[model samples]
Target: MDDPIYDIELEDCPICRGAGLIQDEQGWSVSVACMDCGAETAHAEYRTPEERLEAARRVALLWNMGKVVHTGMSD
Candidate 1:
Protein backbone atom coordinates (compact mmCIF):
# COMPACT_ATOMS: atom_id res chain seq x y z
CA MET A 1 0.00 0.00 0.00
CA ASP A 2 1.07 3.56 -0.56
CA ASP A 3 2.17 5.70 2.31
CA PRO A 4 -0.35 8.10 3.80
CA ILE A 5 -0.20 11.56 2.23
CA TYR A 6 -0.82 13.33 5.51
CA ASP A 7 1.98 11.38 7.17
CA ILE A 8 4.37 14.00 5.95
CA GLU A 9 5.31 16.74 8.35
CA LEU A 10 3.03 19.79 8.20
CA GLU A 11 4.30 23.30 8.69
CA ASP A 12 1.74 25.77 9.87
CA CYS A 13 1.28 28.88 7.77
CA PRO A 14 1.79 31.86 10.02
CA ILE A 15 -0.43 33.90 7.74
CA CYS A 16 -3.28 31.54 6.79
CA ARG A 17 -2.76 28.46 8.92
CA GLY A 18 -2.50 26.24 5.86
CA ALA A 19 -5.85 27.15 4.35
CA GLY A 20 -4.12 26.30 1.00
CA LEU A 21 -5.71 29.45 -0.34
CA ILE A 22 -5.59 32.99 0.92
CA GLN A 23 -7.35 36.25 0.12
CA ASP A 24 -5.64 39.57 -0.22
CA GLU A 25 -5.98 42.88 -2.05
CA GLN A 26 -5.46 40.94 -5.30
CA GLY A 27 -8.13 38.41 -4.36
CA TRP A 28 -7.63 34.69 -3.80
CA SER A 29 -4.33 32.99 -4.52
CA VAL A 30 -2.56 29.75 -3.75
CA SER A 31 -0.65 29.37 -0.49
CA VAL A 32 2.53 30.25 -2.39
CA ALA A 33 1.86 33.94 -1.83
CA CYS A 34 3.01 33.75 1.74
CA MET A 35 6.78 34.02 1.89
CA ASP A 36 6.71 32.30 5.22
CA CYS A 37 4.59 29.50 3.84
CA GLY A 38 6.14 27.12 1.35
CA ALA A 39 4.41 24.73 -1.02
CA GLU A 40 3.49 21.28 0.45
CA THR A 41 3.43 22.94 3.82
CA ALA A 42 0.53 21.23 5.45
CA HIS A 43 -1.34 22.39 8.51
CA ALA A 44 -0.18 21.14 11.85
CA GLU A 45 -3.84 20.60 12.65
CA TYR A 46 -5.78 20.07 9.46
CA ARG A 47 -7.88 17.54 7.61
CA THR A 48 -6.66 14.00 7.31
CA PRO A 49 -5.63 12.35 4.06
CA GLU A 50 -8.99 10.63 3.75
CA GLU A 51 -10.79 13.92 4.17
CA ARG A 52 -8.65 15.60 1.56
CA LEU A 53 -9.19 12.76 -0.86
CA GLU A 54 -12.94 12.95 -0.37
CA ALA A 55 -12.89 16.66 -1.01
CA ALA A 56 -10.85 16.16 -4.15
CA ARG A 57 -13.24 13.51 -5.37
CA ARG A 58 -16.17 15.84 -4.91
CA VAL A 59 -14.44 18.60 -6.83
CA ALA A 60 -13.58 16.21 -9.67
CA LEU A 61 -17.18 15.09 -9.85
CA LEU A 62 -18.35 18.68 -10.15
CA TRP A 63 -15.77 19.40 -12.82
CA ASN A 64 -16.83 16.37 -14.84
CA MET A 65 -20.46 17.44 -14.59
CA GLY A 66 -19.64 20.90 -15.89
CA LYS A 67 -17.57 19.50 -18.71
CA VAL A 68 -20.33 17.14 -19.78
CA VAL A 69 -22.97 19.87 -19.76
CA HIS A 70 -20.98 22.53 -21.60
CA THR A 71 -18.46 20.67 -23.76
CA GLY A 72 -20.12 17.29 -24.25
CA MET A 73 -18.14 14.04 -24.28
CA SER A 74 -14.65 13.90 -25.68
CA ASP A 75 -13.27 11.06 -27.77
Candidate 2:
Protein backbone atom coordinates (compact mmCIF):
# COMPACT_ATOMS: atom_id res chain seq x y z
CA MET A 1 0.00 0.00 0.00
CA ASP A 2 1.14 3.54 -0.72
CA ASP A 3 2.12 5.52 2.33
CA PRO A 4 0.24 8.64 3.31
CA ILE A 5 1.54 11.76 1.55
CA TYR A 6 1.54 14.21 4.45
CA ASP A 7 2.65 11.62 6.92
CA ILE A 8 4.53 13.29 9.76
CA GLU A 9 5.27 16.35 7.61
CA LEU A 10 4.98 17.48 4.00
CA GLU A 11 8.10 18.07 1.93
CA ASP A 12 7.89 21.83 1.80
CA CYS A 13 10.46 24.47 1.10
CA PRO A 14 12.54 25.00 4.20
CA ILE A 15 14.08 28.33 3.28
CA CYS A 16 10.76 29.95 2.36
CA ARG A 17 8.94 28.01 5.03
CA GLY A 18 6.53 26.71 2.38
CA ALA A 19 6.02 30.32 1.23
CA GLY A 20 8.76 29.91 -1.48
CA LEU A 21 10.59 33.20 -1.23
CA ILE A 22 13.07 34.96 1.02
CA GLN A 23 14.31 38.51 1.46
CA ASP A 24 17.39 40.03 3.02
CA GLU A 25 17.88 43.25 4.97
CA GLN A 26 19.67 44.69 1.91
CA GLY A 27 16.32 44.84 0.10
CA TRP A 28 17.29 41.85 -2.01
CA SER A 29 15.42 38.61 -2.38
CA VAL A 30 15.09 35.40 -4.44
CA SER A 31 12.89 32.39 -5.00
CA VAL A 32 13.84 28.75 -4.44
CA ALA A 33 12.86 25.41 -5.99
CA CYS A 34 11.36 22.44 -4.30
CA MET A 35 13.58 20.42 -6.60
CA ASP A 36 15.37 19.00 -3.60
CA CYS A 37 12.40 16.72 -2.95
CA GLY A 38 12.08 14.42 -5.94
CA ALA A 39 10.79 11.33 -4.21
CA GLU A 40 7.52 12.86 -3.06
CA THR A 41 6.62 14.29 -6.42
CA ALA A 42 8.18 11.57 -8.50
CA HIS A 43 6.30 8.71 -6.93
CA ALA A 44 3.05 9.32 -5.04
CA GLU A 45 2.15 12.86 -5.92
CA TYR A 46 -0.56 14.80 -4.14
CA ARG A 47 -1.53 18.44 -4.31
CA THR A 48 -3.70 19.84 -1.55
CA PRO A 49 -5.26 23.31 -1.82
CA GLU A 50 -3.16 24.65 1.01
CA GLU A 51 -0.08 23.18 -0.61
CA ARG A 52 -0.93 24.69 -3.96
CA LEU A 53 -1.61 28.02 -2.33
CA GLU A 54 1.74 27.90 -0.64
CA ALA A 55 3.44 27.00 -3.91
CA ALA A 56 1.60 29.78 -5.70
CA ARG A 57 2.58 32.33 -3.09
CA ARG A 58 6.20 31.35 -3.52
CA VAL A 59 6.04 31.53 -7.31
CA ALA A 60 4.15 34.81 -7.16
CA LEU A 61 6.76 36.35 -4.96
CA LEU A 62 9.39 35.37 -7.50
CA TRP A 63 7.51 37.07 -10.32
CA ASN A 64 8.53 34.12 -12.48
CA MET A 65 12.15 34.17 -11.34
CA GLY A 66 14.24 31.56 -9.51
CA LYS A 67 13.34 27.98 -8.71
CA VAL A 68 10.07 27.45 -6.80
CA VAL A 69 10.86 24.21 -5.07
CA HIS A 70 9.03 21.07 -6.20
CA THR A 71 8.97 19.37 -2.82
CA GLY A 72 7.59 15.92 -2.32
CA MET A 73 7.21 13.09 0.21
CA SER A 74 10.52 11.99 1.61
CA ASP A 75 12.37 10.92 4.79
Candidate 3:
Protein backbone atom coordinates (compact mmCIF):
# COMPACT_ATOMS: atom_id res chain seq x y z
CA MET A 1 0.00 0.00 0.00
CA ASP A 2 1.09 3.55 -0.67
CA ASP A 3 1.69 6.01 2.11
CA PRO A 4 -0.84 8.76 2.65
CA ILE A 5 0.27 12.01 1.02
CA TYR A 6 0.57 14.95 3.38
CA ASP A 7 0.04 17.73 0.86
CA ILE A 8 -1.49 20.18 3.27
CA GLU A 9 0.37 22.92 5.05
CA LEU A 10 1.66 21.75 8.43
CA GLU A 11 3.60 23.52 11.13
CA ASP A 12 7.00 22.15 12.02
CA CYS A 13 7.34 20.38 15.34
CA PRO A 14 9.34 22.67 17.58
CA ILE A 15 10.89 20.02 19.76
CA CYS A 16 11.63 17.19 17.34
CA ARG A 17 11.50 18.93 13.99
CA GLY A 18 9.16 16.31 12.44
CA ALA A 19 10.60 13.39 14.42
CA GLY A 20 7.08 13.27 16.03
CA LEU A 21 8.21 12.93 19.62
CA ILE A 22 10.19 14.81 22.25
CA GLN A 23 11.40 14.65 25.82
CA ASP A 24 9.83 16.73 28.57
CA GLU A 25 11.46 18.90 31.18
CA GLN A 26 11.61 17.94 34.85
CA GLY A 27 11.65 19.72 38.25
CA TRP A 28 8.29 21.40 38.02
CA SER A 29 5.61 21.05 40.72
CA VAL A 30 3.05 19.68 38.27
CA SER A 31 5.23 18.59 35.42
CA VAL A 32 4.00 16.34 32.58
CA ALA A 33 6.03 14.16 30.24
CA CYS A 34 6.08 15.07 26.59
CA MET A 35 4.89 12.10 24.60
CA ASP A 36 4.51 14.02 21.37
CA CYS A 37 6.40 16.83 19.72
CA GLY A 38 3.39 18.83 18.56
CA ALA A 39 2.34 20.27 21.88
CA GLU A 40 0.74 23.71 21.72
CA THR A 41 2.93 26.53 23.02
CA ALA A 42 2.44 30.24 23.66
CA HIS A 43 4.85 31.08 20.84
CA ALA A 44 3.24 28.70 18.37
CA GLU A 45 0.70 30.16 15.99
CA TYR A 46 -1.36 29.08 12.99
CA ARG A 47 -1.53 30.27 9.44
CA THR A 48 -3.75 33.11 8.18
CA PRO A 49 -7.28 32.71 6.79
CA GLU A 50 -6.17 32.50 3.16
CA GLU A 51 -3.39 30.06 3.97
CA ARG A 52 -5.81 27.94 5.97
CA LEU A 53 -8.24 27.89 3.06
CA GLU A 54 -5.48 26.62 0.78
CA ALA A 55 -4.60 23.97 3.29
CA ALA A 56 -8.28 22.93 3.43
CA ARG A 57 -8.29 22.51 -0.32
CA ARG A 58 -5.23 20.29 -0.14
CA VAL A 59 -6.80 18.22 2.63
CA ALA A 60 -9.98 17.77 0.62
CA LEU A 61 -7.96 16.49 -2.30
CA LEU A 62 -6.20 13.94 -0.15
CA TRP A 63 -9.47 12.84 1.50
CA ASN A 64 -11.07 12.22 -1.88
CA MET A 65 -8.06 10.19 -2.92
CA GLY A 66 -8.42 8.06 0.15
CA LYS A 67 -12.10 7.42 -0.60
CA VAL A 68 -11.21 6.30 -4.10
CA VAL A 69 -8.67 3.86 -2.74
CA HIS A 70 -11.15 2.48 -0.20
CA THR A 71 -13.92 1.96 -2.74
CA GLY A 72 -11.58 0.44 -5.28
CA MET A 73 -10.40 -2.22 -2.84
CA SER A 74 -13.91 -3.02 -1.57
CA ASP A 75 -15.38 -3.48 -5.03
| lDDT of residue 13 for candidate 3 | 42
lDDT of each: 0.30, 0.34, 0.29
Q: Please provide TM-scores, in order, for all candidate models, with all chains considered together.
A: 0.29, 0.24, 0.28
Q: Rank the candidates by TM-score, best first.
A: 1, 3, 2
Q: Tell me how candidate 3 scores on lDDT.
A: 0.29
lDDT of 2 by residue, 1-75 (tens): 332211222334543334322221122222233434431121111156455345434544443343333456645
Poorly placed runs, candidate 2 (over 4 Å): 1-46, 64-75
Clashing pairs in 1: none
Better candidate number, 2 or 3, judged by lDDT: 2
Ranked by lDDT, top first: 2, 1, 3
* Candidate 2 lDDT trough over 10 residues, lowest sum: 37-46
Highest TM-score model number:
1
Q: What does candidate 1's lDDT look like per residue over 1-75, in tens digits?
A: 453332333334433343222212222111112233332221222255565444434433332232112121223
